[model samples]
Target: MPKSKRNRPVTLSKTRKKGREHKEAIVNSIKQALEDYSSAYVFTFENMRNLKLKEFREQLKSSSRFFLGSNKVMQVSLGRSVADEAKPGIHKLSKFLRGDAGLFFTNLEKEEVQRLFEEFEEHDFARTGCMATEKVELKEGPLEQFSHEMEPFLRKQGLPVRLNKGVIELVSDYVVCEEGQPLSPESARTLRLLGIKMATFRLQLVCRWSPDDFEAYREGLDLSDVESS
Candidate 1:
């Protein structure tokens, strides 16, 4: 028999074990992301300098309840259905990961999430951002089917429209559609026509629980609405 050289076994130090534990914690967090999180939004920032990214991280740490991690790790941790559905979108996000990749998780109603996105659209760093992807579906029916009461109101918000190629086109340029931002001439007219009290940026309502669950959460009383017993 010929003598053979053997390699020594690798040993993990305390720091390495701690690192592994931390990674597992993050994975667990991602696994729980969809339990009560009926609403999830994926957004990417363009031209986000390191300082700005740090500031954004602090801002998100303030109110949201979610975890952000490497796409590959998160995809592996997520449920099969969620992972499958998000695969294409996650792939799209992989390109943006060079800068900063984040997932917003919440049980809040989709409309509320949309409002938050709009509210922060011009927060010095979010203007350049766009709604990367969403899961919510806006059903099509008669104009009245969706909601007509807001038509008159929306018309007043400065949003103008024209019949272009069998679709309504906001005659003016695109508007910020949110506070602290400028509006394009055409978007202004359309928004005014739509009577939007607030701006509707590219903020999209991504995936959410069924409409029924969402409606119940919306209508149910909150702590603010409760009286002392």
Candidate 2:
């Protein structure tokens, strides 16, 4: 019952040195993938949705593995330089692991792999600060889609709405959102309530590697950093 130890001094070394084990685990996993799969590809993602990605991972679990974290650790695992590379000619693939990127290891036919990646896309609700994909406007009329109880909430969200005959009604024309502009917090919430989805989650191939050859899909994959390191 004397003094509290909550404010006592403590070292910050562990926070800086932590995750070494996790990094080693990733490195080992990638090295093992090198042996398990015949081909590897580096890809970039936009607006990631984890639940959807998990479902996707589940679908491909039989013939592939997905690695999506810590670009620096991944670069080290694949080898940043020729001398340290786990496999020959594979370190070049590391350059493309710059931002929002991950690695794919699979033995599926290249055609099948290409088809899967080219077609995989997800649509999700736009969060605040996300760009509106299309303009959304409401006319001056009864919004039969919403119940009377929602009238108060709609007005609070900047909508000119009211209750009419036990239905939510818009008293004046309202532009909930505009195309090619960032959605406000209120607008984003409105979009969700209206069942509108504007965010497109997608993945694009950056580069590919194999035992005998390599292919570059897109250009300028931040090569200078890898070159200098």
Candidate 3:
């Protein structure tokens, strides 16, 4: 009888698992947004507010879709190179995905979209770790903005203060925050109590793309001036 062939050692296959259905879903949604609208835009935002964004979405629900997600995924959806660009010259948009960027798909006329973006502005209190856009200093005197009852709380927030005859008074000038520095927790709280809003929420149109054209829509134009003009 021939000797039984030695059993071969079992080896596992090196195939990786396919578990990224979520990324695929994101890509598909982006593609849908791209195809459903007449045009697409790349936008950048600063100090975004979720509720405000939701409100903006609702306001445009009938005519547009706004997509904020992974930049890499969006770039993939739009195409990384000219050969596979979602539309002619659309790959140019992928280059502007530098910061807090998102895609806006709309059927509204281009000028209308630009006007809407220019008009959109939200103001909010600066959070801790947010850079101060300007110096916030409290003069050495009574803080009339805050009531006497808030003196204790103000003191607790690290402000040099005391209740002098039913008034909250700062013992000396206090630098709550300095321009170009991250706002401190104490400073942020104090600023809020003083009713100071240092953060401005705004969206900017970086570029727009259509089947026939792709270009930077509002380069060097002051959005504020545009809105006013």
Query: In terms of lDDT, which candidate is strongest?
Result: 2
lDDT of 3 by residue, 184-207 (tens): 898899888778899999999998
Q: For residues 153-178, could you state the per-residue lDDT of candidate 2 as single tens digits?
A: 88889999878779888888999899
What's each prediction's clash count? Answer: 31, 0, 0
Error of 1 at 76 (Å): 1.1
lDDT of 2 at 138: 87
Report RMSD for candidate 2. Answer: 4.6
Off by more than 4 A, model 2? 1-18, 219-229
- Cα lDDT listed for each candidate: 0.43, 0.89, 0.85
TM-score of each: 0.35, 0.85, 0.82
For candidate 3, give the lDDT: 0.85
lDDT of 1 by residue, 1-229 (tens): 7555575566666353346677778767754655545555555444334554455457665445544566656545542232353332222222222224456666666666666655643222222323312221112322332244444444455434334344444455534344444544534443334344332223322323332332112233242311110
Better of 1 and 2 by TM-score: 2
lDDT ranking, best first: 2, 3, 1
lDDT of 1: 0.43
